[model samples]
Target: MTKREIDEVSGVETTGHEWDGIKELNNPMPRWWLWTFYATIVWAAGYTIAYPAWPMISSATSGVLGFSSRGDLKAEMTAAETAKQDYAQTIAAKSADEILADDQLREFATAAGAAAFKVNCIQCHGSGAEGSAGFPNLNDDDWLWGGSADAIYHTIAHGIRFEGDPDTRYSEMPAFGDMLSKDEIRQVSSYVASLTGNSTDEQAAAAGKQVFADNCASCHGDDGTGDREFGAPNLADAIWLYGSSEAEIARQVRTPRHGMMPAWSARLGDTTVKELAVYVHSLGGGE
Candidate 1:
């Protein structure tokens, strides 16, 4: 049997380990440190039994506490749905004017309308409602069929030139290519462009003024002011749906492009359509 060695310097025992001429001291860990290490082991064991810890083949082992993250999420979602239902019921029972009159209802309707617009309208009207070449910007006060709340509501509910809805707003600009010569078309195009100061040829525009009076003044008023009854847009305004350039104007003169919007009454129902109208009106554009 190998006898344990004791250090000669302080009379402490050696650990029977040696590297070259050096010996390791048999020092015991402090009581506090030992207790802490033991406590950690006990905590870890208790935690494993109280919470989910083990991995199984198909699923994890549920701990004794029986808590589930999915259940908590479902409870939260149910509460939100219940709250939303209350507001939805109230909106369904009220008219557009009545809802607007009540501050609480109007706020709820505006938020709901904004949400619907993001889902259904961002494709055409743009994310910020700025609009593109063919689409009309919802952010602006310039409106073709009038910007009144009732008018906007009607347009949204029934749509514009949509074949699916019989009550859809309808207007047709006759293609002048069928009746007028190419030069005449350019002349008329310049006249229309000149209304908004977008014309390139002054002489042509002067000559086209007569052409507009003879051919186009019926729908678009004599001074180029649009009639809302005819769904005609104001040619005098700089807000051109297609474009403000002479070439674009000439193209439109030759073959007028009609814009269309689908009726939402059937698809979205009355409540949502009213909400959408309120939201669009509150964008600082509705009259």
Candidate 2:
């Protein structure tokens, strides 16, 4: 056994271990630091015993205090739902128009509706309600059906071209590809495009005017303004569900693509549907 050596310069004990020419000092840690380290170990042990810490194969050990984050969250959610019960009940009983007429109910419905829209309608209507191709933009004034609160509620409750619902808003534009000659389809396309100041062919548009007046004027007004009762789209508007280009217009003239919106009332219920109508009606374009 080798005896520990003392440093000649400081007269302190050496660890008796050396690397090269350097010797290590046998310096003990400060009493405060050592005590703190021991205290932390004790605290960690206490914490483990008092709270959930150990994991098992199927579950974790429930500590003595019986605290659970999931339980806390469930309690909070229950409290929130309980508080909203009255408001939800009132909404269920009231019509969308009646709800909109009340300022407080309208405010609540709009906020709730906005939340629902993100979950249900955002895929087609977009996050900001700006529609994509084949979908109608909700923020714009142009509505194929109608834009009023009642109208919007009815449409949302029943849906557009939804075959499942007997009361669904339904309209069918005859596919002109089967009905008209190719040249006649092109002429009518030029006329329709001309309504929106998008046509280039003057003679074709001229000939197409008669074609439109004869075939399209019955559903779409003589001036190309839409008929809300028939759910016909206004041809003169800048907003187009498909596209406004000549090729797109020609394609629609040949074979119109009718978009379908699901009847949300059947799936989401009346209260949520009313809220959705209120939210959509508040989107600046609602009449």
lDDT of 2 by residue, 23-134 (tens): 9989999999999999999999999899999999999989999999999999999998986777889988988888989998999999999999999999999999999999
Cα TM-score per model: 0.76, 0.77
Q: For candidate 2, what is the TM-score?
A: 0.77
lDDT per model, in order?
0.89, 0.91
Residue pairs clashing in model 2 are none
Give me the displacement of residue 32 in model 1, in angstroms.
Answer: 7.5
Clashing pairs in 1: none
lDDT of 1 by residue, 1-287 (tens): 98878899978899988899899999889999999999999999998888778989987868899877778899999999998888888888877767788898889899999999999999999988888989999988898888866688889999999999989999999998898888888888899999988888999999899889988999999998889999988999888899888899889888999988999999998889989988988898888
RMSD of 1: 4.4
- Top lDDT model: 2
Alpha-carbon runs more than 4 Å astray in model 2? 1-12, 45-68, 97-119, 122-129, 176-184, 282-284
